[model samples]
Target: MLILLNILSGVALLVWGTHIVRTGILRVFGAELRRVLGRSANSRLRAFGAGLCVTSLVQSSNATAVLASSFAAQGLLLLAPGLAIMLGADVGTALMARVLTFDLSWLSPILLLGGVVLFLTCKQNRAGQIGRAVIGLGLILLALHLIVEAAQPVMQGEGIKVLFGTLTGDSMLDTLVGAAFAMLSYSSLAAILLTATLAASGVISLKVAVCLVVGANLGSGFLAAIGTLGQNAAGRRLALGSLFFKLAGALLVLPFAPYIARGLSFLIANPRESVVTFHLLYNTLRCLASMPLIDAVARLCHRMLPDRADANPELRPLYLDPGALSTPTLALANAAREALRIGDIIRTMLDNVLELMRTNNAEQARATIRLDDDVDQLYTAVKIYLARISREQLDEADSRRWTDIITLTINLEHAGDIVERVVTNIQEKKILHRLQFSPAGLGELEDLHARVVANLQLGLSVFLNSDLKSAERLLAEKERFRDLERSYSYLHLDRLAGQSQRSLETSALHLDIISDLKRLNSLFCSTAYPVLDAAGALRDTRLRRRVLDATYGKDAA
Candidate 1:
């Protein structure tokens, strides 16, 4: 019992180490990896290489899958290239498993010591994240040593020997056991390593080890599929295609497992080395051979899991992927994209407001107002999503970016509410009351409405790119908009003094609409303030210190 417990503990440590390594590497290089995958759409070979390189760094193919699926979900990657990437990811994981099986017991203590010092001293920076990955590497090496030592004693028992004897001739049962271990461990690399260790200890035959390796590869596909259960149709299809490839590879290879093991044993006498080598060679050859079929498999996956249209597409949060939250930079980017959706919804509302004013379409006004609810729902989703990201994991720049995304989303949500109110006011005060503005007043309002819409579009651009020149222009437009509002108010007063009947009847509603438009303009322009302030272009206060000194004293100023 104690031996079994120790073995389980070692396996648990291995899984935890893989998790730490994956998260640490992702946090440090997640955005760069995203760009590499995003740019790999031009060719299958490039995409495959990108996946192989990325998974090698992160120490988990699942991390690479998440990144690829995210790109596919966002329409940045096509299905064929995505499957090619997964194939590369499989080879990468196989290579890493082979590398880990080497005798690195001497380096474990050094890595653990250095990683602990670095992580403790620089807890919130890139160095700290690197330290985290290093620590995980050390833990993985140590766990492998422990698993081998613990399994030796357990396998020597009569009951274990009897259990192992049954798996010797039954290849299918051995394969199922291997697949179960891989899924349970949540890592095919770990499962394969354990199988190799058991074979080395003489508890399992070389043939059984070979069959398990095939099953372990298939289990990784299952792991990827399970990981993508919450993803969009594109993401799920990518996983399905990868799964099909692995399943097909496993079936074709299982029947020949004994012959393959016999061939491997002739070349290498060590059972452990033979198993690991077979794994590496099998994945490399299978992926290379299967590359050409990527397009066909992708089409099949699409047919199996076609994209389903949402009943209310506007209400759905498209880019706030839950899988991205582990990597702060990726999660922030997803949130930013989702926030832009809110900005778009607000723009449509503003357009609808203008149309409502012109046509007195009460039903249209109500329809537009409901969009505000969608904005609210999206705002809540983004806020909660950002909140789930641990602040300690974010570096200084990412922390600032996190705050900026929250600010933009908040401004957009407020803008949506303001537009909804403007539509409501137009409906209740103008349409319901049967009042009409004079030609001059209506024309002035229309012009102001157009400017507001333009400013909103500009604001979204600034939010996305944070260009200094554009931010400056947006701020300048805000001042110009304020001036226009003041001048228009005075013009309405002039018409009132002239006893214009249309102006007199709709005087209050016209001024109210003008005030609302000016407020909307301010909301849209708020996206620029952070950019300007960060660049030191914005002043601390608009009030003049000289005027304060003259009115009171230097102390007051």
Candidate 2:
């Protein structure tokens, strides 16, 4: 009973350690990892390499899959490359298993002590995150050491001997047991390592261990499929494709299990070494062999789980998958992408309104209002989705990003409302009354509307990429828009004084429309302030000190 307790406790420790390592690495390098994966989408080999590197660094293939799945869900990556990444991740985990089996037992205590010190001293910074990873590594190694020691006594028990006697070299039964261990442990590396230890202790045959290792790989694929259940169609497709690869590989290799086991047993005398070596060889070959089939699998998965476009795509929160909330960085990325969609919806509304102003078309105006409804729904959904994310789990930078996404979505929502009102006012006052602006007034409004659209585009760019130069340009445009709006208002009043029929009849609508455009520009340009302020490039006051000085000099004169 005590031996069983130790083994179960060790498995629990291993799982907890893996969780710590994954979260710690993500917190420290999430954005960089994202960029790396994003840029590697040009080819399959590059994607594969990226997956291997990322999984090795984070110590979890599941983490890599989650990232790839999230990217697929958001249309940031394609299916073929995503599957290639999964294959690479499998090889990477196997490589780590091989590395961990080395003789580094002495470093565990030192890492634990140092990791604890750094984590306690700087719990909120990068240093502390690295320390957290180190502590997790130490715990994993300690757990492995404990599992091995505990298994030896358990192997000696009469009940264990009887149980082992029943399963004498049954490949199918052993394979199932191995998969169960992997699923229960939540770490295939831990499961495979424990299996190797069991084989080394003569508690299991080498042939059974081989079957178990293959089963562990199959179990990981099952785990990925389960994890992606809450994801969108694209994400589910990626998971399903990877699962297919695993299943195909497992089936193809099953018939050869006995022959391969016999051959490996002859090549390696030590049972533990043979099991680990077979694991390394099997995964590397299977993944490499399966790489070319990714495209085929992707097609099959897509056919199996076709994309279900929402009836109202714009009205829905497309990228805010609940599966991503467990990973704050991934969740934030999804939110940011969805915010861009909101920006696009507002852009469409503004474009429609501008056309209505020019053509006096009620249909155009109604379309703008409909788009506004989409904007409101999406904005509300995004805000609620972001609110559900646990802010305390985020680091400082992520927390700031969270706030930025909320602010941008709110501004876009307000801009949508403004555009709808502008369209309605134009349709009701100008189109209904058969009012037309003077030629000069018409040209000025067209130019202002064009400028507002450009600023909206720039604002979206600034919010999406946080580009400093673009942000500065946006701020400059805000000032220019204010001046232009003021001049247009003055010019319209001049025409009103002259009692020009066109300007007199449309005077109120002209001023109202121009003012609303100015307000829309203000909302669009607000995105730049946060970006610029974060970089220390933003002036505290909008009015330049030089302007204040010049105004004082004029007063003195």
Point to the candidate with the largest TM-score.
1
Clashing pairs in 2: none
Give the candidate number with the greatest lDDT.
Answer: 1
lDDT of 2 by residue, 281-348 (tens): 98899889888788888889989999886886776677887766766787898889889988888877
lDDT of 2: 0.83
Residue-level lDDT tens digits of model 1 in 194-242: 8888788777889999989988888878888888888788988998999
Decoy 2 TM-score against native: 0.90
lDDT of each: 0.87, 0.83
